[model samples]
Target: MDITIHRPGELTEPLRRAWHRAMDESPEYANPFLAPEFAIGIGRHRAGARVAILREEGEPVGFFPYERDALGVGRAIGLGLSDCQALVHRPGVTWDAQELLRACRLSIFEFDHLVEEQRPFAEHVTGLFASPVIDVKPGDGGYPEWLRGSYPGLAKTTLKKERRLGRDVGEVRFVFDERDPRMLRTLMRWKSAQYRRTGRMDRFARPWIVDVVDHLFHVREEHFTGVLSVLYAGDRPVAAHFGPRSSAVLAAWFTAYDPELRYYSPGLMMHLRTAEAAGRNGVTLVDLGRGDKEYKDWLKTRELRVGEGFAARPHPVAAGYRLWRRPVRGLRNTVLAHPRLRDPADRLLKTVGTLRTSHRADSDGAASGRR
Candidate 1:
């Protein structure tokens, strides 16, 4: 087996095509977040981003795109960020984890939502995270039926709320895409404000994310495009969502609503419209992303596990550092999980905020205006 690393621009067509093919072939490859396009999308904005391709018998067997942080510390290509990570490979191929690490020239590598099958690298895999999903496939009765079937109680409650909202507000209308850029911009603004108001780091503040969202806005292809949905009360936009959708999956990425109209629960309304549109469009799943939010259980048909975090060399020196760092990562995850730690996290962003802001300005459409 031979491994090679290629910088972003150095990536060749053959490699890109091969990656797309491998991703398409892998049964576990669900999130478009793991797609080659995502790597390339983020690659365009990150420096030192590269692809690690492993070959056996002159054929590409595995590919790992990652970024090397300070002191050669490595992370999933877009670490502290991008949502998915794994070695792209064909079935039945045995990959030596240590060799791959050596090929990447890393002293330490870590991931949080690392896939279970990729566990051969580590001695132990702990921690379970839940990402909510909504099945939008028309199933036996269609999306409406699927909704009733999956969450009869929640669906009934939602219907009751919808009626009360209608009586208090007005008629509700659902728009898919809207084809209006301003609506997406409004959603971003609302999301950004929510992030700040809730003391969270605003993702829209990152230029690469903003750029990617804008790019995804117009890059609509079956099973690989961004989706924008908005709910309206008369002429006013109440709730909206900006996410990615595929032939069978609609991944709910980001969403927001008008606080003044919170009585209508526009976020939930937008999610309902998402289900309706996805079903109408032949979509089968609505991934609510990673969270333990209440609606997840309410609207979810089933649950799937996808995450990061990995096992490294565990050399005495390496093991020692990891042992020390384990608690730190745990603390960080704990903080990120709660709203209370958000302020300090936001303050930390202030230190790197300029870099984030400047990077977005240079990338233009690649990132949102503020971080």
Candidate 2:
């Protein structure tokens, strides 16, 4: 296949349409991140993002949205800690993946979450990873029935709690596509606080994350859309889920609940509502994006393999860096590999968070009531 490189800003309507068509044609392609809107959104916000447009017989066949960084490093645009893969295209089209690197002038391409389907360039790959998902379709009666058949204990427990909570709170309601921006802000705030408490970096700290959220908020479509579902206890939002919804797949992306209301399990309730709505909307699957959460297994019927390994063009500069980076990566992996070390490492991070909070409090007290 003959592939041409194009600057992110230079993408045309035909190119975008072809890219979407290629992705739409692929059965394995269900990610919103692989969509043109997502790539364009990232390109508009992130610097140095470029699109590699592949062609055969003067017709577009594939598209990849990548960000060129210092040291000739390239990665999927907006792929920081995200579970989706890069280099999205139709099947049966083969090209020298290295040619793409040469076209883009990239040295090393790092992909922590690259898809396995694009393994033609596996020689240049770095690592392998698994992204877990749940198939929330069983044709019986949507989530409620699926849960009863799959996880009867959990279903019974959750329904019992739901009944108790509803009795206490007056009425429990689920709102989908809530038009208010305030609900999204509340979910972000809760998620941010959860990250801090759990010693994970707040993703919203990055400007692109904020822009992506705001962009998805306005992007509503049948197959590609952002659905914000909120569980309300007597009109007060208790839990909210911000995820991508499609005709057949509703991906569980981001979720959060009020800490004080954790006892009611509002998050689970919101998820239940989402699954029901997805079935009602002709959705065949609700993908709870890659993780080992017990709830996922309880709510899902099967798992799909998603993500890929990194590939790159052979450049001496990039080769040298990869060589040196290998040992460091190995050491880090080894450390994380040990369950003993991993647990302590996590604890240490949590301790550091507590200390940071204390120091911040002291500084704030010193500056308070001062102008």
Put down candidate 2 lDDT per residue, 1-371, tens digits, no spaces. 67677666678877767776776788566677677767666777777778888778888888878888777887777776355666767778877777788877788776656666776667756555445554554447655576677567778888788788779875777787787889999999998877777778989877778877878878875447878888888878889998776556677888999988799888778777777666666777776765555577666667766543456566787777667667776776666667788778878888877777678788898889574
Report how far off residue 207 is in candidate 1 (Å). 2.8
Encode model 1's per-residue lDDT on 1-371: one tens digit a residue.
88998875676777766776676677556556666666766677878677888888898867788877555566777665545567877777777777777887776677665655675554534455666677665557644566577567767767777777777787777787777899999999998867766556888889887887787777665436777888877777888987766556667878899978777566776787688777777776777766666666667877777654555664554576577778887886687678778567766766565566566568885555554
Cα lDDT over the full model 1:
0.71
For this target, which candidate reaches the highest lDDT against the unseen true structure? 2
Instruction: Report residue 338 deviation for candidate 2 (angstroms).
Output: 5.0
lDDT, residue 371, candidate 2: 42
Provide TM-scores for the models: 0.80, 0.89
